[model samples]
Target: MAFGARARLINPRLGTYFSIFAALYTALFLLVLIFEQLKFDESFLRIAFLAGPIVIYAAIGLCVGTNDILCYFAAGRRVPAAYTGLLLGASALGGTFIVAGTGAFFFSGFDAVILLMGTLTGFVIMAIGLAPFYRKFGAFTVPSYLGRRFESRGLRVITAGIAAVPMLLVLSAELRIGGHVAQRLVGGSANNLVFLLALTIAISTAAGGKRSFTWTGVAQSIALFLAVLGVATTISVMVTSLPIPQLANGPMVRGMVRNEVNEGLQLIKVWPMAFQLPPEGFSALTKPYTQPFGSIGPLAFIIGVFAIATGVSTAPWLLPRVAATPGVYEARKSIGWATVFSGLALLTISSAAIFLRDFTLDAVMSERLGPLPQWLHNAAAHHIVTFDQAATRLGFAGLKFDRDGVLFALPLLVDLPSAFSYLLLAGAVAAALVTASATTVSLAAVLGEDVIQGMSWEPPTTQSRVWIVRGFIVVVAFCGAMLCVTAPSDPLRLVLWALSLTGASLFPVMVLSIWWKRLTVGGAIVGVISGFVAGAFAIMMGEMGTLSTPGAIAGILGLPVSFALAIGTSLMRPEVSRHTVEMVRDIRVPGGEIIYDREMQRLQLRKHSRT
Candidate 1:
């Protein structure tokens, strides 16, 4: 039994499993393509496209599931930095970043780049300041690390509860977005699809925990990249007669700028102009595609970036990937790869937006327009964009596009084969599933391991612990689905709320725990609670119209308050336990056995002796 278990832990045979999945999906794609050629019903093809990858992902998860605690919890700590990076990158971007970010870029133009910039900055902060230390500490969850570092189980439980808020918010948003994509593909009520999506995610997460999450994440990322590249490349060839969308988009942007000006379109002043408005008044047309600061003010832009970057760096869902790496150096390398992969996708999305905007301008502004263009009708059929032909003229002002649906509707707008449209939605669904699964898996680990142990003062047996986590996965996934279906906010706003709350509540306390030996339980508790309250209040006020500022930047107010309270509280209680000081010193070293593993062994030994 020992030998069999050891072999199972040592060898997941992930490459073979992925190869099988690849073959299966390729066959499915060919089948769908044949049906398209044969003029089969469009709804049938849409259902196939939406459901095929999901079934395969679930199969992969079930195949990878393991009863061994190490394999289930952390993939036996053997994943290479590159694979870990790919997984992290995919999860980090999620459905919201790919779908909503692209839509925001399509509409907001240069203003959206500010958010991307902040998200990328978060990767740098994680790589430099957080990932290595967390990996070196070797906790299974963020709350676990906090509990161990502070030497207080009560603090662990509190921190676990606090961390769940942002992660849950993110989980619901991803599910909501996923359901929306499904609804577009299959023409059904989104509420039912959301529950279905939640069940699928829970099954995958519960089956193998992070072990399933890692390989599936890699597969999902590759699929998303392919879909994005396919649409971008096709559109680029049409626009610039070149294959490289990122490079080709430059000329197209310039053309759009010149065309807009010639048509008497002026930049839309998104925020009130600081001084008098320009002679070409704001009401006439859309903003120039390349113009900056027209959609969002500089102050809000800066605040949004800062808040998002900080929150992303400390996100609880990301740290488990760090612990899954082989060592501190590997953890750092993993985050570096995450940055590269995410940056590549972001750049591709940005270029795609420019091409899309150029297409929209041509369709509306061309003199040859006789009836509403086929592209507009096609887009309208899917409810991707709204327009009133009787009330409004044929310009940007006449159409109000759905930000969530813009990327999904891109292929149809370009008159590509309807298959490409399904492919784009497939990519969006893949991203959503991977992120939702990762978030569910991480939250399960927090609640099952850290929260449970902190409350009970005694760890359950390994078998029971794995089962407990599996149960929590189902519970958490369903709760998220219910929230998304019943009371959904904009996916982008939900993401921002999650980020702001995370940056405010956890970041300051977490950073101090790593860098400051004087950080006490009282300080962490006060800082987390205070920051969380301050950020939540700001978001509420912003939403209620009580505060003039945008809700996206509300977390900024919490950062300073958190830092001051934590620092001052620690100073007032200056006594430091020797063991905690040594633990702090030990985590900073890159080369050492995992501290969490050592502590676990001690605990197990003590329990055995007591028995």
Candidate 2:
């Protein structure tokens, strides 16, 4: 009774401490907003506004640091539902959403909306189908869950490799995007910026692992949402002359589309019909701006949505957050909160893209009579926007705008105050940092715990395991940073690729492991391998010019392939043991010991016996 009393008391106090910490950071963020409204030197304001939040994040990580592996791996499994939900939302709203997503919307029109809807639907599926069950099962990592659920160490190793591929690829893309933001704000070579950002992510992640990420993720979510909301709302009102941009931006967008159509028609009269083209080329040759699918097409749009939604539902980086929740109820509730928050942010992002597109057409593209806007001038100076004289006759002078630069360049295009631009940049960086940190930690934890330990006869000591995770964190960070330097891809494309791969390779297995008792070890292994290969082939086809556009639907192919293989192979193989069957049954229902510390449970049992 005394031990139980002590335990209950400690958990609340820990909650209180983190609550206070979060409140302090929130207060500090408000103060920064106040400061932004005041007059200050451009460079000084930029540095201070940008550095303040990052320093606070690092400080939080340092304060949260612990040697306890459970604390490091799962934030002691005591994180509040609200915070975990916010972290998941923040992780979902990475640089791709804030930065590259805007450009995608600019180019693809309503196709991007479908993708956002798909992502939100994924969260709903997670809340209803996966999160609660995973929390009940109490696995620290995805591979660990799969390994125990299927009773196969080799499957665990294979899952780790599959998880690592997308995580690393996505991390590298995020780092490259973050580096680009930093370079624009502070001025440095892209390679150096990537290295520095990678180091910062490594330090913050290694400092306290998931504990640090949880706290920092809340702050990041707030910053990113505010940056996006503030800019979009203000710009929407400016364009539409209405109080609510969410509702009011429609007419403005329509007018802009009409203008683009008129310009395209004028071009066709002067040049050949084939020669007059939209910015996205052949796929959007007719009424590009007004079309629902634009260059992406309807099939691709539907596939992209499913691929992204499934990806979010089964993302390895996201699953651990669910496991860290305090109970099955909270785990389920948290997914709803994450979905709501992410949905709001996406709404703001899509609105901003439409508003910015209008601004680009009126202010930047049509300003052929005089000097370009200061924002466009600076963007061109940075090589973010380039002009090609050869295509000038088609009503667009090959005004090649880097999609990744859209979010960063939006403020400048609208002539917002420099302070606001810096804040936007900081938010982009925060978004990247949140996702990068989570991915890094997940990579390390899975590699160390599932791959290395699962292969060994004798497990390492707790301290050794902790060190192993830390070492993997460093190695993964370095490798991802190097990839950022040499093989940087578009942030949104890379994110979709990662998501599609995860959805194809892991989502089916995760669902089956929790709900399907017939899932055999051999079947799971074959499913993962075959799914990965098929997904990779689909992406390769898109990249190699076989497809008109990148096959966002590759997961559509891979997922069915995996499902068939798993079902077919499981039928051919022996049934899993009754013990495994019972375990699955138990996980399906709610109400179990939420805290999953095996060692602590053992000690508590001993104490009860002695009493």
Candidate 3:
């Protein structure tokens, strides 16, 4: 079993193989300091400058491109639709979604659990109601679908523009995250020109596309899941009986500590009826449930339902997977199970961390820390403190004064065994690679579908087209890397913004295109463009401290505006050709199987006619 696992984990490609070595080396380095007194220093210079960006980019390039690109080439022409779904799902596992969950954790605390339920609900509803139609259209790019639905060059341009801006930003965020992870691993020996690192990552990603991205995602998800599992499990065992922190420290303490603790316990208690929950406790679950349409909130439920329902087609990450395999439905059938298991696994890890976080914080505040030892950052609870400092205390060992840093600083203090430490560290690198590879390919496809082909530009040869795509990948990567090296933001924070923009903006447009037949060419074009602009507009505005509610609303209006514009305009404008309806009727085949029979049927018909 060990041998098989080793063989499976180790890749044959030079790039992947090199990354494996780096993982092992970094593990050894961490192992030496597993018991050390190193503090969590997350200053930009420490985290970003100290880490080598190019190498990290190169590593992800292997994971994302190799298998993903191979699978695409192997599919020949007219790629299967189901493979696209698989690829999309795989890509979905990257830093973006992980950070989305993290963002929810930050803003609303555990009370934000409702958001997770709502998100899942949205996906399920969309899948059952609208996925088939979106798949049927058989369009490869989001903009292509816009063209099919609206058929107006203006709409296509707008849709492309909408998709392009956020997509570029998304890529930038991934680079930032990947660079940070690389920097952390590289420790004292980071990189010079961050763009150089970005370009390196982009090149590797461009090299493989479908084949590489698929395998890389598989690698990233597996590595991350296992690493987090080990960490969460250890903490769980250590803190199973831990209680939520209460602020019995004073009158201010009573309101802040006790109420906070009590509310937290209500949200977390596995058995709800066992203990009485505060009135606020019940409301916490629905705090973010906005635009409620009456008591049971049928409208809100539909929002979740349709979001999930249409999620199947909106995420373009799945496209390469579709083109790679032979069976479409066969592949689609596998998604629910895959996502279910994966979601459960990740949730388990996340929940364990959350429980640990609350319990530990409470213990420290009340000075009830028995044998469990104060986490690294307990030093800074001082006269008055911030949650960031509280969270920082969760690390292995803290420098006397470094607890003021963000939650990401915990990584520097972990004390895993060499083997497992390397294994876990490898996972972060894997995450970067998976994302970089997927983004690189997706970026290439967009350029192909929207820029060149949209303009009636064609390469002189198949190879030339391939090279053009590769060239574009490198260029896009270069631009992203430059931003990473130069741009100033928390690496992980940067990733969150990237994913938030992409998902919030694009998801709505993709959702509308699927089932709402009234989602005319005009509608989809308007919707996608609106989603794009609204999402971007929010990100920039929020950054300037203009938005009053930091995360309470979470840009839900982006989706509504997208829907209203698409559907409203679709209804009002002269509808484009009925081609989009026809396209969706035919394009998709679910079940996610490896075999297809259409070619076989065609050959049989040809043979019979000859006879």
Top-TM-score structure, candidate number: 1
Better lDDT candidate (1, 3): 1
RMSD of each: 4.1, 5.3, 10.1
Report lDDT (CA) for all predictions. 0.81, 0.74, 0.45
Candidate 1 lowest-lDDT run of ten: 273-282
Per-residue lDDT tens digits of candidate 2, residues 169-254? Answer: 78987898888888777875978978877777777778777777777667677677767777767776666677566687778776
Candidate 1 backbone collisions, by pair: none
User: Candidate 1's C-alpha lDDT?
Assistant: 0.81
- Better model by lDDT: candidate 2 vs candidate 3: 2
Estimated TM-score per prediction?
Answer: 0.93, 0.86, 0.65
The model with the greatest lDDT is: 1
| Candidate 3 C-alpha lDDT tens digits along 1-611 | 74463344334363465457447545534544443334433343223322333354456546444322223333232233333433344355455344333433422343334334533453454356434434444344566555545555566555665555545655666665555445444443234434544555555556665454454454455555555555445444444432211211123222433434443322222222111111110111211111122122333333332333333335454433444433334234434544564455436434532443443344344344444343333313321112344342322122222111222322323433333433434455555556666666676767765677675422234465556666777777777666656664544334334444445566765655554545666566666667656756765665566853222222334666776787778778655556656544444444322222232245456766876
Number of the candidate with higher lDDT, 1 or 2:
1
Q: By TM-score, how accurate is candidate 2?
A: 0.86
